[model samples]
Target: MATSVDKMSTDTQAESIYFLNAGAAQAEQDRLNRQHRLFDDMMQNDLLPPHVASALSALKTPPKILEVATGTAVWLTEVAKTLPLDAEFVGLDYDTTKFPSSLPPNITLRQADMFKPFSGDLLGKFDVVNVRLIIFALKEGQGTDLLLTSVEPPSQAWFRFQDINWRFAKKVGRDMNLPLSMVAYIKEAGCVDCDDKAYPGNSQLYTRGREDWISRTNVHVKALAEQSLRGITSLGGVEGMTTQKEVDELLACFDKEFEDRIVHYLFVRAWGRKPEAD
Candidate 1:
């Protein structure tokens, strides 16, 4: 019966963080919602892990779920559909502009910075806390940025994009490799049964039985590339990519690489359970 984020303020704190792909444009929000669906499909349409889902269902009271950096609340809203009607869903983010005006009756959206502690009432309250694709929000030394890796052979154009993305991330101080370290961070936080699963982008045409994943990956990559370029150019641009013409030319090359089946990246999901009170 406790509220999700009772005392947390609802003011935007956009300037407090450095996010390379940050945007509140409708196009950006649409891209994020599309990416959310792609990720849900990649995980086989399950919002939470099997065990977690089972635990939440078995709870006697209405379960509390919190999603950090929840853009558009697409994932949370979808998860809400599968749970009890009274189950509570809370979404926290620094920017409220992207938050949807209409959410499920059981859901609440709040403005909060992840770097800061939540109000005392929120501590030890959530039945599940979900954070995804938060690499852009981290600061230097908080995480590392590494080049993309794939099982398939990369094309020259793919490599070029990798180099560009690396340089752009460096210039903007965004961490791209934090996903690789999430399980370690979870274990360090004293969470039990920590584990992670990796989903490959699988843009390879020869990968049978994954046609859907291939299509989704390609679409997600293209949209993300465009969004990143928009963000970069808005920042007065990164080296070798300071103009709209340059961004377009690079995107064309990236499209060719995707069409030729020459690009892929691993997406990892890590989770752990907090120790219960004795």
Candidate 2:
């Protein structure tokens, strides 16, 4: 399929798109893979529910699966391994630099900006569509709303929502947050039987270590802070909230305050199904 950048009303609007950098490309790729593993372990090795899995597996024809912002396509690749031989898997992202050089025969990777409309062929053509960790990238609710509108409603769609919830910790501190606006967005997009479950971040596989875990967790948190700063500044700069330099200083303070403070996050997995046609 032909994937291209989304159209903007003004050139300035088009030039301001920002992607949070987690160090170099390789580091970012590694982070994403680790993230996938963490979530997989947390979810008991099942990405989706048994009902959803059964739905896709029972399809007479080859089921088509689409993953949005599929960085490194790690989640898609793993899910592909459990599917039928004829299953077709597609992963889309704005940058393909991290996509595996070699992919399974059933899997396809494409470079596509999530901010824009999906290619016509991709509209309403998936049995399942998966999206994760995208809240920090788009402006407030813009990204989730846009993504929901762009994709053709599949038989099922699942979203993994993330937020830094310091309230769960014993210590008081600032944390990056994701609001519950996505629940409404899913319903507004005509999804039915919507449901969600929340999980603690520390419950993931990465948190199951001793001294080594502390060191690795520190690195992960620092990278996340940097990424969050970039996202906030990029969107805020467009809206005249703050400049990049100011964001840098504010993030430095945030880092200090966060030091030794109990870190906690909440991830919510939500799913819904499109109504069958009459």
Output the number of the TM-score-best candidate. 1
> Candidate 1: which stretches are off by over 4 Å?
1-24, 144-146, 149-157, 203-213, 255-257, 260-262
Q: What's every prediction's RMSD, in angstroms?
A: 4.7, 10.0
Q: Which runs of model 2 end up more than 4 angstroms from their true locations? A: 1-18, 141-179, 204-216, 230-262
Could you give candidate 1's per-residue lDDT for residues 38-120 as a string of tens digits? 66655667788888999999999999999988878888999999999989999987666678879878999877788788868
Worst 10 residues of 2 by lDDT: 154-163
The candidate 1 region of ten consecutive residues with least summed lDDT is 1-10
How accurate locally, in lDDT, is each candidate? 0.72, 0.61
Candidate 1 CA-lDDT value: 0.72
lDDT of 2 by residue, 1-278 (tens): 22223332233234434445423677678777876765676576778776899998889889899999898999898898888778999999876667888988999987677777899999989999998877545453362221221111211111111112121111122112343555667777899988777665555435445344344544565565566445544443323224677556655655554333334456677778988877
Model 1: number of backbone collisions: 0
